[model samples]
Target: MTNKLKLYFKAAQSAKIGIWEINLETNLIYWDSVTRCIHEVSEEFIPTTKNTIDFYSIDKNRDEIELLIERAIVEGTPFNKTFQITTAKNNIKYVEGICQIEFLNKKPIRLLGTFQDITKEQNLINELQQSVEKFSSIFSSANDAIFIIDISNGIITNCNPRASELTEYDNSELVGIHNSELFPVKYRKEVRVFLKSHLTKDNYIVNETYIKTKSGLTIPVEVASGKKFKVGDQTFSVCFFRDISERRNVEENMNMLSLAASETTDTIVIANPKGKAVWANNAYLKLTGFNLQEILGEKAGYLSKGPETDKRTTDKIRKAIQDKQSIKVTILNYNKQKEKYWFELNITPIFDNNNNCINFVGVGRDVTARKEKEFELRGLLEVTSHQNNKLFNFAHIVSHNIRSHASNLSMVVDVIENTENTAEKLSYFELFKEGTEKLSETIEYLNEIITIQKNTNIEKKEIRLKDEIEKTKYALSLSIKESQISIIDTIPEDLTVCVIPAYLDSILLNLFTNAIKYRHPERKAILKIGYEIDESYTIITFKDNGLGIDLEKNGHKIFGMYKTFHGNDDARGIGLFITKNQLEAMDGKIEVESKVGMGSIFKIYLNEK
Candidate 1:
């Protein structure tokens, strides 16, 4: 009874209608509380087999119930059925009866059964069936060709209406065809291998290949295929095919344009409508001294513009791009090393069929050499004019100086010829000889100047400044001692600079002589030699504490030939002039700083290694 009650409770949770038991041998019967409740009987009411059979409708329902019970009891078979029954209140209710027989010694002895209400379960099953039918309808109506293939045999098991339309075949004709028949002959084997390899794995694989239509025309397609599921012994894959002929055509045109741009000498850059670089070729990278990684996705102008860039040209370029017009301009551009170059740029806006700008293409050629040549020509013209004036003045000065010496000799000759006393005649003869010697010296100085001016080729070699300074000091030792001068050399022992050795020696010798010649009368002179170097030039400085010249009065004339500021007869005013010429011939320069009584400093700049 406890087990029977547990069974009744389990069935009640699932909306079971009733539970019953019958003894076949003695014709005894039992009914659980659920069976009594289904009949609407009182708790204490006794039940009999006759009244229970009478509860069912007195028609085919009653006969069926009697037959199902007899089959269970006599044949030991289980039976389950649902029928309408009238309760004690005369209300009809649908209830299920399930019966199983128990046998003792191979003969049926008792039967037990359970009845459950399945109305809700039946309603859910009906709704699910309807949803499946709706999903099938939608799948067939899709626009793109869809093919469902059996993975193992590569056969097309099913396909939608669009598949037939795309392949130009009837739906019934495409159903049993192998999937390989859809692909072009060249790719059929590859398609077969792909399907077989990936059929077991749950993955979506896509490929762009050709497909053959019904009329034997090949069409390019992009197919997305993957394993959909496995049912029983068959594995299935669903593939979606899209036409890509238009995309292929666009790619071909792009390839042709790229080829043309690459073969040209000029650098070509392609920018989007917003003026940002999207692509550049090898020529572009080579021209700008930059790599693709450095320039891509950057503003087109940023790669080549700097502080020296012309703002007017940049504004013009911006306006031209905004107006979708072509522009040609020559602009100064800087490379990675910050070296400037002139570039001639031609930018043209590319438009689509609708007349809307899609991109801006620029072609640039480096024109630095041509621009430099133009400037060089203008500079040469100015230099030629200055040189002509200098030559005219030089010739006049030479003539005047020679004529003055000639006139002196003439006066001396007259004196010697007219005089009667022997001693007086001898003095006049001596005067004549001195004038001739002065004239010869002047001619020699003029020849030396011409030689310096004409000789432009000077071979340069590394010379140690400290060694040269010591050598100059030794060469001028006698003069230095006579003037009572002190020498201090502060140049490094290894401080070497590239210069013409003879020119360097001559320059230093002149500086030493000048320092000694112009020594202060009150104190002994002090000469200091030092060397310094900067990025492009090596500087050697010669400083002296002596009777320094007044730079404000004679600075410009200090290096001029035959220009003298001193009252001494030995001051020929030629040493500094020759020194300046030597410095210039060796591609060097000299600067002087001097005060009236303090000292003079001459800085000689030479090209650094």
Candidate 2:
């Protein structure tokens, strides 16, 4: 081939175009290497007129191209057209065909054309058309009022049908109006500022404002201004407007309710479903003496608890909140001043549309005076019960001790009378003196117990448990050392218990002395002291490796007045009884485990159950 022919071939290849020719007179066809490659056929394969037409993917394309080629051959016409062709590999492609008829002596001799692959260009054009159609559909059918604005002039260049409905204006009238005209007079300036700030941004800007309709009514609206872009040298912004009048009305109602709550004297608190406080009314803030910052994010009922708050009441409130239920409780609470108050509270759960707990509302009022009166009456009742118990003990002592003393005196007098001896009579007087002295001591002990039990208004003071234990150990240092006993103090240093100080001291002294007095003779004594705390009580254990009581026989009588298990001469048997009574007086409890030879374990409940 000449250099010129090679240059033309190179140009066609660069353009992705192939050359083809057909001899009309001979009905033969020629395909260049590029054309053969386009058909996905081997270079050695030759094509003919009949076989070439088979490459047309559809009958319409085959007939259209055939007509074009016939017209070109018969009338010496030229044509350019785009059609689909299936290659030898059965793959479809769009190709542009340009053909020109070559003439010999005014009769058509051949047909030549360039076939260019236009598949990529056709695909791009189809995609662009689809995007435009989708955008048009959304713009015309959207629920929100849509508007296109000319950014340079703030004019409403175009708007959806919904915009006309929202403004109660004709479409023709709305297209030329200033964008700010849609907003009320009071909000137009602000809307303009929002629009200016938004149009330069890369994202949509949202805000709340009021719009003025053609009917002269102002309605609340939430608007979002879409990003701005240039179209045909004019920068435009698309904006959405939504009617929010109903939402505004709901918000206004909520504000009115809030105002009412803030003014009420009853305490009101609002918390999340998790029990964390979100808001508290003025009365609640005054009652707790906590600022918003101090309580926000904290559990609603937690801040007012103190040394005297009943754990049962608090637990009831907590479980109610966790279960998404409502509860009513009258509980004692302490303010920031550590001053006591009684609150009658009602907590209700707020649920969402899905039946899920979204918030909790608590309302309460101070009932301190009524509560104080009730406590006084309850205290009196408790005192009377203790007095009755004391009277029962007194009666038992009288029946058991006084009768024995009376019978012994009678026997002694009889002895004196029968003997008729002055020395014998004088000795009998000594026995009388001993009997009367024993009765007097019993009366004194009973009087002491009566006084202790009658003080029903015993104030419980918070005391560090480990410190009190150490103090008791120090007071009994000599006895502990003499007993040669091992002491294991395992109570945590920071543990605290609230109880009457004197009662606590007495109970500790009794337990310690009792342990030392009953030490086993055959083995070294070991006392392990430790404690465990639960939701409402602290259990302290005193485990002793010593002579254990026979619980099977003496268990019922262990804590009874004047009851003794072992035959120790000095065992008055009142220590355990007094210990039990002291614990009861302070709303505490005690339990014991013992065996004949193993050891003893005493578990004392330091706080109320």
TM-score of 2: 0.48
Q: Whose lDDT is greatest here? A: 2
Error of 2 at 356 (Å): 12
Model 1: residues >4 Å from true position, as ranges? 1-10, 14-144, 160-165, 200-202, 271-279, 292-609
lDDT by residue for model 2 (1-609), tens? 799978998999887789998888788888888888888899888897678889995689999989988789778899999999999999888888999888888888988888888889988888999999998899889989999999889899999889988899988999998988888788888998898788656588899998899999888899998878898899999999999876676467557868989999999998888999988898998998888888999998788999989999999999999999999999999888889899999999987567988678899999999988998999888778876755654454445445534554566667778887788789767766655664464456456555655554545778898887776665455457768988888988888888766556556766776788788999998888988889878888999988899988989899988887767885777777767876776678889999876789998887743
- How many angstroms is residue 92 displaced in model 2 relative to the true structure, after the best TM-score fit? 5.9
Model 1 lDDT tens row, 448-527: 55564443343477877788787556444445666789988888888887875545655675688778878788987898
Candidate 1, RMSD to the unseen true structure: 19.0
